[model samples]
Target: MTQDATAVAAAKVAGVVRELTARVMQYDATRDRRAVFAYTYFRLTSDLAANLRTNTLSFREPEWVADLSVTLAAAYSTAMDAIDSWLGLGAARPDGAPGGEVRAADMPESIPKPWRDVYAASTVRHSYVLEEVLFSMMAHMSYDLPLALRALDPAAHGDLRRHIADFHRMNDLLASSVDGVQDEISARYCRRLHSLDRLFTRDDELFTSYGIRVARGMAWFNCHRLLDPDAAAEAQGSISRSTAAFIAEFRSPDDWKRRHAFRVLRALVPSRRQWPPAGTPPA
Candidate 1:
């Protein structure tokens, strides 16, 4: 696509992102732990989508991979809708609605139960920003993403490949944003220990690499599985188990080593005592 066409294509996608971002910011994710993640994802996806749309960020092939942008944005938008419904911010629809253009006609039918399971567990803000981000990634990449890819024509394997690249690119974007995201999380949920942000950075490279690899694996596996349902069924347990393990790690309050380290750090720092302090109150 030409430059003007490319901009035009991304324009619609950008507009949708603006709308979703507003919804995300408007919702008070402060009271509920789940809302923290809801807000995190909404903000993350909104930024990424807006970037991709304007060509401020470049994926493998912007013109050819435009669908990837729209589809992924739609997936995030749908999840946001799910959050709103679950939290009663908007009208709930037990049956999912594929909220954006370029989404599967039967997205509700294609979405797996695991997606809902993770969202449901977000009721308490036990997980750190990183863990919450991972949980959201698991649901979207493992469950929602495959269905989105599967909805594409099998012959369009080339398109699928580009989308996979776009997926990892977004993962890289997540890696880049970890510090900012953690700041947001700390501001909202970890007000007592925002100064210890360094605790979460030790495993940053490993975490980003692992997340990108897993997203690629899930996308490929799902695309192939769509071509062969019986084979996918045979291997379903393995897929479910792998995804379950990732989710299990984040779902538990005690899963993050950084949190433990922060506790130890807090003990060593004298001034850190008196959380919420005398004059400043917790948000």
Candidate 2:
């Protein structure tokens, strides 16, 4: 695609992301746990969109990147839409009434299993916000990302190395967004997150960034496996099983112990002054 074409595609994708962000913010207001991930996703996509518009990163294949963004965002949007429809919250309902009884078996096959797990967990009152967000991240990054890459077929565009380089460049963007995203989550969902952050200090950001780096690195490896004709079938199953297992681990009882430890540690530490002061809140 030409530069002009890429610009148009990027703009369209940005519009889609903007709409999804609005929907997710509304969900957040309703105390929907899924918003944990959705809000974080919006933050990351907003940063990506800004970079795309300003050509800040000078990505080797901006067009391919833009297309992948659309694919990945569309997958999330589609999964959320399916869940909404199943739950009778779809916009298509004229009276704002339930869409009527629907069984899980009736859900569209296009909505992947990882996303199903995400929506299911969102209904649990005891689910931690951090775990919800991580589950959503795993679904998007670990499960959907490699498939999105395969769908785009990077080799058809040009040199595969250029595509890989652009992919790694995204790691820097993810790392930079961690602190801001954590702040948003703290303010909107869990205020105690501030105390937790003070306990860990900069190590909090470092750990989150490291996790993003590792997950994305695995995604790229999976992308290569998906592209391999002989490995494709096994790769598909592995992606689903591995993502589900990762999410299961997050739901384990041991996580409760870890969370309890953080709470105890936070209580033992002195509280630090929060940013923007008491009178001036985040806009």
The top-ranked prediction according to TM-score is: 2
Each candidate: how many clashes? 2, 0
Those runs of model 1 whose alpha carbons end farther than 4 Å from true positions after fitting are 29-32, 53-60, 79-111, 124-130, 154-159, 162-171, 192-210, 234-243, 249-283
Model 2 shows how many backbone clashes?
0
Span of ten consecutive residues with least summed lDDT in model 1? 97-106
Return the clash pairs for model 1, or none.
33-125, 34-122
lDDT of each: 0.51, 0.66
The pairs that clash in candidate 2 are: none
lDDT string for model 2 (156-259, tens) is 33245557878878888778788788888677667776655454443332238888898888888888888888888999998877755765554442458665
Candidate 1 local lDDT, residue 279: 30
